[model samples]
Target: MIDQILEEIRRYETIIIHRHVRPDPDALGSQGGLASLIRDNFPGKRVYIVGEETEDLRFLVRMDEIADSAYAGALVIVCDTANQERVSDSRYSCGARIIKIDHHPLVDSYGEPQWVETSASSTSEMITSIYRNHPELVLTGQAARLLFAGIVGDTGRFQFSNVTEETFLSAAELMKKPFDRQKFFDTLYQRKLAVVRLNGYVLQHFTLTDEGVGFIKLPLDLIHSFHLQSSDASTLVNCFSTTEGLKAWVLFSEEEGLIRARIRSKGPEINQLAARYHGGGHPLASGATVYSWDEADGLIADLKVLCSRT
Candidate 1:
């Protein structure tokens, strides 16, 4: 798969990289990491990473502003995205060809030579394998930093069950580069005062069901009261994850007329449940959307049932 993707890379002079919307570390990491690999090894190739920017994660990497004409004969490669609808840039289809490199379970297949490795920990790890297989490819410090950040973010600092021998091996390999690990950790975890206060509110208000199902609903008004955006609430999903008897958890943060559900589990397969509600992801982690508060309650009820059975 790496050789096939490398072949495509070699074929295209103009390459654009993309990832999922509501960009996370792995999304930007793999997108930027792969771009760096291509740029360094194939210096003449025009590589660009495009996506809507997030304030908190801008330090890791930034997006490029390319004209539509750039995609006239470009090769678009999407990383860390499971579904086509969730892809960040609509212009991905403007390219002549599309490739998918992701670690999530297949949700909607679109690209040719789709490389979806559900067991690969994170897409950044998969990107690292490219350099491992082909030593001639230059692994720059910037690429190593981006890929390391992605792996750490997706694996919860190597604490999540997703981490495996290959994950550590990839990290070890990337560590051979010269990026500052301490500075990266410090910058990646830096939070604002508003987010810190909201964390207190969540700790005080989140509910845990007797069936080991934990959930928290953050209304738009409540999030606004904290002077934060709906996306900011996503960082708090795992805040109460360590609660005793917790089998599964859901964090619902309201947006304009709809609520986004970030679901996590230790026992139940929640991606199928997420798919039923307009979302899909890994077995232990997933996301969905609800149109109303009542619908949000319905999701909680379903999660409780799932936990009870587990």
Candidate 2:
């Protein structure tokens, strides 16, 4: 699959990279890392990263805005995204060829050359694996740094269950290039006073089900009270993740008249549950959006049942 991806890259003079909407570190890292790899190995090719700007990741490389004409003969490589609707940009379809490189479970196969390795820790890990297989492809220091950030971010700083021996090996390979790992952590973990206070609010107000499922519902008013973006509020789901006696945790934040949920589990596969509620992701981590609080409560009830079984 990596060979086929390389062949496609060689065939196209313009390469455009994309990721999921509301980009996470893994998404940005993999997209930027791959773009850097392509640019370094094939300097003549035009490589661009296109996506919605993420305020949290503004410290990293900025996204590019390419002209529509550029996609006429471009090769689009999407990273860390499972479905077409989640893609940051629809212009990807304008490309001459498309390659889907992801770690998510297969949903809709949008590209001709699809490489979905669900076992990989992150899409960044998948990109590193490709470089490992094809050593001739130049792995620049910037690319290595971006890929390392992606791997570490998705694996929860090497604490998640998905951290395999291969994950460490790939990380070690990327570490061959000199980058300030400490500085990266400093930037990633840095939080403003507002964020810290918001976390306190979440911890103080979280509810626990009889079956040990922890959850919190943040309405738009509460979100505004904390001056938090819906995405930022959704990240607070992790605040309940490590609580003792809890089998799973979820955060439901109201956005644009709908409730968006971020779900996490210490046991049981919740992605299938998320899929039933209009969202799907990894076994332990997933997301969904619902039309009403009742629907969100239904998801929580289902999670409670799942926790009881475990």
Clash count in backbone of candidate 2: 0
Lowest lDDT sum, 10 consecutive residues, model 2, at 228-237
Candidate 2, residues 1-310: lDDT per residue as tens digits? 8888888888889999999998888999999999999999998999999989978788767999889998987889999999999999899889888889999989788888889999999999999998999887889888998999999889989999999999999999999988888898899878767778889999899998779899999898888888887777855679767777888989999988789999998878999999999999999999998999999889999998898998
- RMSD (Cα, Å) for all candidates, in order, is 0.7, 1.1
Pairs that collide, model 2? none
Model 1 error, position 232 (Å):
0.9
User: Candidates' TM-scores?
Assistant: 0.99, 0.97
Instruction: Give one digit per residue, the lDDT tens place, for model 1 in 213-256.
Output: 99999999999999999999999999999998999999999999
